[model samples]
Target: MTKATLQRRPLVKQILANADDNLLVIGGLGSSNWDITEAGDRPLNMPMWGGMGAPVGMGLGLALAQPSRRVLVITGDGDMLMSLGSLATVATQQPDNLAICVLDNEKFGETGNQATHTSPRNNGPTDSGAGTDLAMVARGCGIADTGTVREASQVAQLVKDLRAAKGPIFRLVKVMVEKLEFVMPPQDGAHLKDRFRQALLGHP
Candidate 1:
């Protein structure tokens, strides 16, 4: 298994440290939902309570709808793997304002900490020995701006790209697996939708 040193919460905090009105964030289900909420739950923040593979698609639609806003989708590796095909769709659409960051812990945190496909295989006698590289997958999907961050030093640049770089950009951040307290947003989905709509459009 790859040794991921960066912690999730601090990294998430840094990502949204200077967030502004034009920045809209979509947090995927499970840990990502908690991470963004921990960062600071705002009207512009929409944390998915149960949608496993819908964050990217939602972010893409938001980007297309609001061309002037920066739309960032923060999701887990397991969630991203479930929607890999969405990368191709995003590539095809090529929304310049859209960006995706996959927080890869190499384990499915919401599902009993199972090793995900992103985890490197042990290469046993029957193992396929295939490894998942999300950034490379994005590149293969025709996304020119893509990166994988494994060190704290690279985070400053990663933040820059996430906040201001021309996109559609894709980033995979390798984070350490540690049990953290859940920081949840308001539980109602309708409230979240209405709140986000009002924040973005001045109407619900």
Candidate 2:
């Protein structure tokens, strides 16, 4: 976590720059929801308001439902940790169009910048002295296409994999913890869902 240099906002923007009708994005709760909104709040982008660990699951379902389209789940480390088991389900399903990109700031951003499990711990009397590796977890859960992006230089390849890669891709992007403005989407969940349905389908 200490060695991370990439900023989340720009990285997120890069990921969604080429988003077309064929792409469906699920932004995880908290900072990622705002990050995706800042990138561009399109109908194809479903930014969660309160669901902490449901983005990946939603992405999986969407990918299954729309096999021809690409489904990307952009989530935070905190949210990912809450439902690491979902990775196993995704791997089991093996959706070719589903990709998960975890924005690991190593902190629980919404609940005050508290250290998440992904944050490195010191060998102190009260600490475990170990940090969880999410990419390893994904690999262990049967996902072959998994990687961690710590430096800005590696983002280009990561973006390629995210946008145009094969089935069940998992990536962890280590981002810096900084206070950024919240660029919110529509506050109403039903309204957002209905709009998304109307856009993706011909009716809501």
Candidate 3:
């Protein structure tokens, strides 16, 4: 089936609009970081600036530590692909409060838009073979609540699943490739950590 065209900013805004104080969001570096900040800068949101594949692992740890809070990891496809094995580990641990959403533009947006494994390739030198199906990989790793979101119509359900699905859930959201201006959050790592810690734990 052909994928629907969706913009990352609106989709992210819609998802976060429904979120509450109990939602602990961990954003992957680069575009994912900007997207979440664009949605809204909250004390509960932790946007990583350097860690490439750390969001999922960090979200898992946070979820395990705070079982009552819903942990959402927002990352790019390239970042998620780098830590593919972490999916298996997440499945093994089966943290019910954790969910992962990959904003898959199918290219390495941060590094000169290089085609990632998730990018579709034809028979040519540039081909990296067929595009990787991340939702399938997540399901194969025992995440039963997994899906790909390519339509605006799917956004509502995606938000609902992120909030209430039996996790560790995974979703691959196909977003458009656009050069939007960066919407940055506070870049101070220590400050971000202190703010998020204070919001979630009531103390920095």
Residue pairs that clash (backbone atoms under 3 angstroms), model 1: none
Which digits, one per residue and each the tens of the lDDT, describe model 2 over residues 95-126? 99999999998899999899998887886566
Question: What is candidate 1's lDDT per residue for 85-192, written digit by digit as tens?
Answer: 999999999999998999999899998999998887776566866568999999999899999999999999999999989999999999999999989999999999
For residue 102, what is the lDDT in candidate 1? 97
TM-score of model 3 relative to the true fold? 0.95
Query: Which stretches of model 1 miss by more than 4 angstroms?
Result: 123-130
TM-score of 1: 0.96
On lDDT, the stronger of 2 and 3 is 2
lDDT of 1 at 149: 98
lDDT of 1: 0.94
Tally clashing residue pairs in candidate 3.
0
In candidate 3, position 117 carries an lDDT of 83
Least accurate 10 contiguous residues by lDDT in model 2: 121-130
- Per-residue lDDT of model 3, residues 1-204, tens digit only: 365489999888887886788899999999999999999999999999899999999999999999999999999999999999899989999999999999999889999999898878786586665788999999998888899999888889999998878799999999988899999999999999999999998999
